[model samples]
Target: MSAAALPAKPARTPTTPSARLAWLDALRGIGALAVVAEHLLPWFLPGLRPYWFNLGIYGILVFFLVSGYIIPTSLERHGDVRAFWISRFFRLYPLYLAVIVVMLALAWWVPVREAVPRDGSSVAAHATMLLDVVSVGGVADTMWTLSYEMVFYLLVTALFLTRGHERSGLLSMVFAAAAVVVGLVSSGAVLAGGWPAYVSCAVFVVALAGVVLGRFRTAAACVLGLMAVVLLLMSSRVPWLGVAVLAVMFAGTAIHRWERGTGRLWPVAVTTALVAISPLWAIESGWWWVQADVWITTIVLAGATFAGGMALRGRRLPRVLVWFGLISYSLYLVHHPLLKYFVQISGDLRRAEVPYQLGMAALAVALILGVSALSYRYVERPMQALGRRVSRRYRGGLQRGGDTGVAGQGAGDHGVLGHEEGQVPDRVRDHVAQVDPLR
Candidate 1:
């Protein structure tokens, strides 16, 4: 058989411009929107609520699944794990630090004491990406997931260092095994009365598994899904294990879809099931097993929705949603703190008044959007340009020395799967070339 006749293997492409992946972008926007709605519930909507913001929890799962799909692809593009980590640090840390600094300044200068609690534990946790690890409260409540992303990055880098990009199967197994070990260890610890350590370790393990195995071929997805189901059944008896299982399953399923390709009707079916049944299942089953089941369902459904939307016949996302996707990360990181500050300063405006709350919400959204745009333009873009320059220089140096794979020439552009569609442009490549002294 001709090579072209066989089923194509899944491979990470380098970053380049192509048609945008609207499904993933749309999913990100939806996740961010859900978060905004959940936060607004306390101030705006009352008595019409159902199930205590569980939808927000599901939104978080979508974020994780999307992360799993994208991060490894990013590592593969840069050709050097150390460089990838450096780039991630540049991209994530500046905004994070800026937010912290702003919050601290506001606390001291504005006479509002609310920013004080945002310091200490919350600040420490956010700084370290260990919010859940340290049990901090007021920092960025949504930052708990950033901790997971950090852990996943570390694990993927380790895998890349040891295995390069050749042995994806082996990498997937290692990831799965690590998760199992963590889950078992955490479960034992919980049974032994060290619940804090147990929860922390368990969370780390599950997230690790989610990122690693999530890139594996489709078969692993079934195994991960079944494991999640079993974990849900056992969660009432062992809550930590249950959560870990759900994470693993969600990652596995997302990876499977990413690898195998999404069919037209699949996402539609999955999203429908989740939107219609998940909440009701949670309501009926209560918090015990329901949390696990609902989360697992949410991830699967969100992934499907994204994939399906991307496969749509026409443009799947409006312009606004695509823009939101570009800046979603900044929005996610900045929104909570900004909202808290807004509420604190607007105390004289009658917090209970519907109009006041609505206005505050609108103002918060605008601030988040504006700040995110500015940050992307001034902060992230420059650093990304710098990283590309360094990478090209390093690659040129290797090429001059007659090194082949070191520069990852055969590797396509670094294609982070879930983000803006298409490969990195030639203009970016040439601009970086001009800046790269080594070249």
Candidate 2:
């Protein structure tokens, strides 16, 4: 959901982590616009859409890589499981729920996508943010990516708890291998129907509650990690793709490790190659984007983008790009639904004159950006403020010697997530600021 770099040395004071992180924001901004263009071009300028590579996939891959790079590091730095979950909830859910509510309201003007099942399980799946895996369509189309984001969070939490987090490179390769095996053997969802959604939802709620409440924490994390893997393999709409995506994320973590001097780059190289070809033998029909050539191109470009961002991590990126990154989550989640309604009201722009279509597209972008800025200002900021307060209070209680060491360090040693604006440590602030607008 966010991107970060590990500082080689800790600063005595919180210098300018933001400046160092501008490149990641640049990447987030570019990814957001790329995704917007992917949806917009088809509707208003079909002639501009490329056949060689998929813009939407490329943008999301960038996002997933960014998330992989930052999320686990953020968790490890925070060290407090409760505070980590609290921050995540505050950072992601408020805007996510608001978008879902708005989409449901917009359904009166534009019918909900037929991919969504008219069943209560859809509600359950949404609650868990496991919609894609459970084969329940999201209210908003882009919500599929959030399922993977949630899975990564759960897996990282478990790995951190058990001291297995350092094996990211190995984990990345394992998932990549799983993707290859799954692609060879499976064509579609094997654990089909609403039951997976319902059951997973129940398990997610129980495990998350236990973890956050600090009750049987290790057991809860293990259950969640195991459940995440099981769902990816058996319940996902495309099993190979799910594992492949996880491989991409962990590969991002591997890169972060390499940069930080704790790991090698070989696993990252292997992960990239495996993920690029994961869908080559996939038996699915009708998805032209996943054809061997196109899929390979998408992976290569995403990797290149991440590499570019990493290379520029110390430079000042364009302000416009950074601003777009600030509002990306809202833009990403709300734009598709807004576009649907825009089309419903304006009639099909695809059939309109080219100039008129272009004009309409410009207006749509303005509207989406305006709405996203408002959502960020009014929804995300205040919720994050509240999360900080709650985390501080909860953490205060745990500091009374209840906190124990893990992997030879105090679990609550690091302060992340809810640091008051200027008080944030330089090593951690860039990660927190990026969390300001999750992908």
Candidate 3:
């Protein structure tokens, strides 16, 4: 769709930074609920779960789009690789490690899934947050998405360092085209097992040190980016799907570029079409959700939802959804494990009468929301604040030390929100901090 053909941004609504971000929160809230429902219905209300589209996939796609829209902007706004990575580390890790620890602590009572490799390799992959790409399973099923998020971040950092970030539109189509070719030639991961995880973890650590310490920063970023691509293409459990997910994310970036008048909408449109069909022949024994019609429906719906959010970006969104958005990251990570534990205590509700099952589902959701809100308050919020402080200190030190490299001041673009160069709004930056690794 052309920019002119899209829905007009409502002029009457004020474009305050918070107002601009509310729609993203709303989307995150909706995505989080959809994911929770997807997990819950199968165990608690299997009869009501719709087969028309995969709710989990829908939620994940929405999340990746949101991440794509905001993440690079966050890095650009900071204009410092050290600050950006520090912010990311604190924003994502504190809660992520907590969740993993909680799950492991409970493993004696509720064993970890057999899909997870019980080895040091799992630790290595999880430490890098590149679990899926390295062919190691995460402690939580939802965590596979984090691998892609990490890959995108690495690639974006490389693009930023090399001044190639503006070619998001072209990159989107490239990934999409690669997805199609990879699907045709390869159905499964070729570089499987523990070595990929160990090697990736080592590269991730050394490369991150090089980037942050301002020693061959661009080279470090390029190496990391190349490794991310290799892992996605040769080591991911589903190579085609991995590339396609990256395509969808870059398409989101293309849409942002189009909105900012830096890019045309045609690439986004073409990328969407390509990704929709990229998985048609991806695997020999694909699940029902990946069937052509169902998969296309899910992709189209996710695109429409993002488009809808963009259209309504200027308007005030409902508060409940905004609240959901605030607690969404915690909600996303916490729900599945809690659901599994609840099922253990309550037994399967799938055989129960509809009303009884629904009541139980509602109860579970309430508990999940309550816990998520607390985690947001006690965990995510504090860690994010700490990340910001650390980022500020690092940037301040860089300025004081006259380290005017890419990891120093005034190094990145005017970010996606159209802020003046080096003048990213505090409200927008804070809101962007809440970009869930997986909503």
Query: Taking the tens digit of each residue's C-alpha lDDT, what string does model 2 give over 154-269?
Result: 99999998989999999999999899899899877789889999999999999999998888989999999999999999988878878988998898888888877788778877
Per-prediction count of colliding residue pairs? 16, 0, 0
Listed in order, each prediction's TM-score against the native is: 0.61, 0.89, 0.90
Error of 2 at 25 (Å): 1.4
Instruction: Encode model 1's per-residue lDDT on 1-439: one tens digit a residue.
Output: 0111122333555423433355456667776766665554444443333342245555565555556555655555554443454456556667667666776677664343321233344444455453333333324444445544554555455545445433333333333344444443343212222233334345434543443333331233233333333322332233332233234323433354445453122332333333333333221233421455544454455545545544441344577776776677677766666656665666433336777666766776787678878876776667666655655555545445433244443323533332321111010001111121100
Q: What residue pairs are clashing in model 2?
A: none
Q: What is the lDDT of residue 150 in candidate 2?
A: 87
Q: Which one wins on TM-score?
A: 3
Cα displacement (Å) at residue 187, model 1: 8.4
TM-score, candidate number 3: 0.90
- Greater-TM-score candidate between 1 and 3: 3
Error of 3 at 298 (Å): 0.7
**How far off is residue 83 in model 3, in Å?**
0.9
Q: Evaluate all candidate structures by whole-model CA lDDT and list the values in order.
A: 0.45, 0.76, 0.76
